[model samples]
Target: MPLYLQLEARLRHMIDSGQLRRGDVIPAERELASMTGVSRVTVRKAMGKLVQDGLVIQKTGAGTFVSGRFSQPLSELSGFSQDMRARGFTPGSHWLDRQHAMAGPDEAMALGVAPGTRITRLKRIRTADDEPMAIETAIVTARDLPDPSMVQDSLYAAFRARGLVAVRALQRLRAGLATQQEAQWLHLKPHAAILRIERRAFLADGRVLDVTYSTYRGDMYDFVVELTASSTTLS
Candidate 1:
């Protein structure tokens, strides 16, 4: 096997086995070359392969580090708090706005509530490990959330405490450039690409629980879906 190929395989193994974890910085190319007894050209080639494969990222003046792109399964109905926690990140929210107001037509339709009905809207900057990850806006019937102040961090957790856990949800995903406001909150340049998600959650009794719109940084998030074929039956 070629020397570069061997180096690539070793790095790949480290990444796959979690030895070189997400956000973990790899050693300098010269150091790797000396340690592995390979030429600097071989190390460079292996690093290039990893970058092309999206397993690592190289930043000028910052060296190379494992990519922090997180893959979220599209099949689950989960909240940002739960998802971030499952990934070993500290989940937090910075409230942008929280208030009660008359439901707009779009919010009413998505939440299955009549227009002009009072509702609670919560706008937050979702953070993981103290870094802003996404911007989210959630709307629920005022009755479901009597006191917006009660929701300290996770709205879903607050709902569960009130016996209103969402049993299912429908979500839509889109790709777009970040708005100026989003870019500011997420610490990205204006017009940077982002993932937009809109979701409607429902309770066991089929009542719409809430509607949420989320914008995630495209560089740090990826959505994955698993599909399977069903058997065909003939009579």
Candidate 2:
């Protein structure tokens, strides 16, 4: 086996065994080379493979650290804050923009409202354990949420407080490259892979409650869906 592959395997084992943990800084290339008696070039190669595999991340001047990747179950209907808390991570948000405005073409269609209908728009950078995870923009009719300021952290929580909780939602996910602005907000390099999710949430009475658009860091987030075999057998 190549020296680089061996080193990569060793690092993977350490991470899997919890000898290394999320946000734990990896040893410098020179130090790793010295410790393993491998060439610095081989150490670099191994580190590069780990980064490509999303097992580690390199901060320009801060060295590489174990990646804090999270998996979200697609079957559950929950807000980011709820999800993060469930995973034992502190969830927070940095508000980018919050205002009341007329619904645009897309937002109007998604919320099943007229284009000129008043709406409250809430945009923020969502974080897990203080690490930027996603950018979210949520829109709702002003009648439901009169003010964006009412939402301090989780939009769903605010909705529930107002007795407007969404009972069901339809979500669509697609792969895309992050825009420069999105990259900056998510602390990722320009053109990095991102997952765009559009969700339309409905109230119990069948009225659309909210239309939310989110861009999640692809390297740090995974969406899991459970599959079940068909009940009927194919002859």
Candidate 3:
């Protein structure tokens, strides 16, 4: 490989193997030049590409560092815990709040419940390798899920245990400015950019299983999407 390409691969490998972590600053350009016996130009070139690829971040007065990472797409179909495990990261949740409450107007409408209907409201911060990745506020109809203590690291897992089908999901994504409470939980600053999502998971029989509003740190997350053309035949 060419010199710059070689450097890029090394940096990427460090990130892949967790030798370098999200938000961990790297050696300075001059220091990297000395260590690699490459020119400052070459070192800068390598770091530049990494930043462009979202593998690293650069602050004006600060040096280059690993970019914080979070699961993009945020699809329950994939199962959040499974995805994190696949990446070799320990997934955990520190349940901050759990309570039974009446559904609000929006949540009631989403879950096809009366405005005053009871629901289980659970608040948690999903973490990977003990780093906060997303803040989740979840609501499920008490009629569907009576006991809230049964909640665990994965909501879908709890649903499956009860044979509650979560077949399809409707989700909306928008950009939100972080609030003070959200900032603290997600380890972000107040008013920082966040990826906001409101999702309604459905059952095979078309029952809404749960509704969740989640906020992910923008700098730490990127949603990946793939599109393919469909084939058709004339009848």
Tell me the TM-score of each prediction against the true structure.
Answer: 0.79, 0.74, 0.74
Q: Model 3 segments beyond 4 Å from truth?
A: 1-49, 57-65, 74-76, 229-235
Clashing pairs in 1: none
Q: Which of the predicted structures, 1 or 3, would earn the higher TM-score when compared with the native?
A: 1
**Candidate 2: global Cα-lDDT?**
0.89
| 165 Cα displacement, candidate 3 (Å) | 3.0
lDDT per residue as tens, model 3, 1-235? 8798899889876775567877788999999999999999999889988888788988889888888554354443655677677666788998988989988898889889899899999999999989888898889988777899887787778888888877788888899899998999988889999999888888888888898988888877777555556697545
Residue-level lDDT tens digits of model 2 in 1-235: 9999999989976764456768999999999999999999999999999888788999999999999666577888899988777666678999999999999898888999889999999999999778899999999999999978899879989988898878899999999999999999999999999999999899889999999999999988778789887899856
Between candidates 1 and 2, which one is better according to TM-score?
Answer: 1
Alpha-carbon lDDT, every model:
0.88, 0.89, 0.83
How good is model 3 by TM-score? Answer: 0.74
- Stretches of candidate 2 above 4 Å error? 1-21, 24-66
Ranking by TM-score: 1, 2, 3
- List all candidate RMSDs to the true structure: 5.2, 7.0, 5.2
Tens digit of per-residue lDDT, candidate 1, span 1-235:
9999999988876764446768899999999999999999999999998888677999999999998666678999889988877666789989999999999898888888889999999999999878998999999999999899989878999998998889999999999999898999999999999999999999999999999999999987778788876686544
Quickly count the clashes in candidate 2.
0
| CA displacement after TM-score superposition, residue 31 of candidate 3 (Å) | 16
Q: Cα deviation of 104 in candidate 1 (Å)?
A: 1.3
